[model samples]
Target: MGSKQSVLQENGYTVMSEQHNTIMLKNKDGDQFIIKKLKADQNEASDFLQKLNHPHIVHHKEIIKDGDCLYLVMELCEGGDVSQKIKQTATFSEILDWTVKICMALKHLHDQQILHKNLQPKSLFFTACGTIRLGEFGVIHEWSSGAQITNPEALSYIAPEILKGEPYDEKS
Candidate 1:
């Protein structure tokens, strides 16, 4: 087995920037991608990302477990995330367009019995073509017997039932 950095290099990916657990990589062809280092408790989330595949959702390309840390390679959205767009003063039409696309992505996730517990502006990304792509599944949970609260990092984004320590279904 090779080191994580070596493996990525051997696969033709060069590190462009790294911040905390997320690394931005660029292949020899200049195509960019992101690699998220998953903590031990986030194993299930990695699996969920692999199982999820929708045009509006960020695509999980591969999973590489290097020693204690698990890394997930995902499609990169060159157009940046929703928060950046909002900071730039997005137009009303652009906001409406993003809203519909976000709803579509959420509906798809709900249909798959998955809950995106963290649905803040930062979680929504845009491709180079301006298409919305939902990412950040750090708090994803299976909707079995309703979803369970995974973490309190995004308390404001959490459902009321979850904050109350009550079971939260997809509707919540």
Candidate 2:
């Protein structure tokens, strides 16, 4: 959209939150979404997300272009992210439950030959109903058979092999 104000009015969505380049919106139906604006040329991540489908993954609605910017509309997770939950004192059972959910999401991604290079608490979100869903595909990568990729920016959550400057497979 050209401007956040105009886009909100045109789409019938109210602003829930706003960031420098992104805004969270909610429609009259109570459906929530996150709209992110990026340079027109930066469509790789949005394109990839559009083709992805999984219960534990945030869903992509559509992409719209206004001038030189591309806007990505995606499902919103209202219960917040794992980082907030981690800050609270959680029971062992609760931790195990969340772990299992996250593992299932990772398994689904692997099945699709996708690698979530950044797998931290911030990337893990909770739905309004309390189900864990994986979000933030900004650093995702698709791998062909036997292909390896190098990524060292994830820090503590990154695999050691990546930090060592070695090409690592999806499992890394």
Candidate 3:
């Protein structure tokens, strides 16, 4: 409705950092959040993210449409992503716990006939409370029983069938 800065400020959020299309924000109450700007062409992915509701998934608080861009407001994960965590003293127990959490999230998405076409260590974020959450859902797609959905841009972490341009279901 307004300039992205003014709109976020009016909603009690102040920009903390920004890189590319992603902006980190903080409210007066000390709650942190992330806002990812999606171009008009990525509306389907944006719409898919808005419908997700899961404890292990980055919560989509709201969507702000500013001109041709869609800003997705979501909870902040201060603990960084699994990639960074792996570099630290990642204990066996921690790895096992994270694995279970990730599986749970994947199961949730698969059960809904949705496929997270881009799943990787960097996509798994950790909150300040150390809770794992699935993020970076730029290539998620709603799949039918026999429909083929593939994201050529996402080469890594994608199934072989997707890379081969073959029809793929949730299993892929």
Candidate 4:
């Protein structure tokens, strides 16, 4: 939406520790940017956000700290979330375009050893030019030791092995 001033005014109060909400802000030069505050102690989120380098994935600009709030500034996407466009497409071609983006995002995450426990349509924020970006790292879960991931994710996307009362490790 709106400019940095408006977004900050509305969302600034919630921009504190444990707040996962994303906001819009501007730099010293008046350049608009997107900022998502990751949870403190979430090393996996910090690591993933730092290593991300895909075009389809949101750009990882830099980490900033304002008092106690930790912010991750990223490239802004203007198409809004893909969930907003699904209902308007009456043609197969248009639908395919969105599908391709969704797949690309998944592929990018998997390739990077990161898994999004919440991979819903709403997570796919689209751009004005139809580019799709995978975000919302608050749902991202990964292994701290780079070992096999046997932990259950958010039940919605939890692996079958993890749902069967099997042994799972959070640091997998």
Which ten contiguous residues of candidate 4 have the minimum total lDDT? Answer: 11-20
Show the lowest summed lDDT stretch of 10 residues, model 2.
Answer: 144-153
Residue lDDT tens for model 3, 60-164: 988877788878899988899999999999999999999998889889988877888788888899999899999998777777423233444556677888768
Global lDDT of each model? 0.84, 0.78, 0.84, 0.62
Candidates ranked by lDDT: 1, 3, 2, 4
lDDT at residue 92 of model 3 (Cα atoms):
99
Write the residue-wise lDDT of candidate 1 on 65-167 in tens digits.
Answer: 7667888989998898888999997899989988988888899999888888888888999999988999988778887534455555567787788778787
TM-score of each: 0.87, 0.82, 0.87, 0.68
The worst-scoring run of ten residues by lDDT in candidate 1 lies at 144-153
Candidate 2 per-residue lDDT over residues 1-172, each given as its tens digit:
3685676657677888888777888878988899878777668767877887888888888887677887788888888898898888878898799899888888988887788878888889988998888887766777642223433444778788766767777679
Clashing residue pairs in candidate 2 (N, C-alpha, C atoms within 3 angstroms) = none
lDDT of 3: 0.84
- Name the regions of candidate 4 deviating beyond 4 angstroms: 1-20, 66-68, 143-172
- How many steric clashes does model 4 contain? 1
**RMSD in Å for all candidates:** 2.4, 3.4, 2.9, 7.1
For model 3, the superposed segments whose C-alpha errors exceed 4 Å read 144-154
Between candidates 1 and 4, which one is better according to lDDT? 1
Local error of candidate 1 at residue 118 (angstroms):
0.3
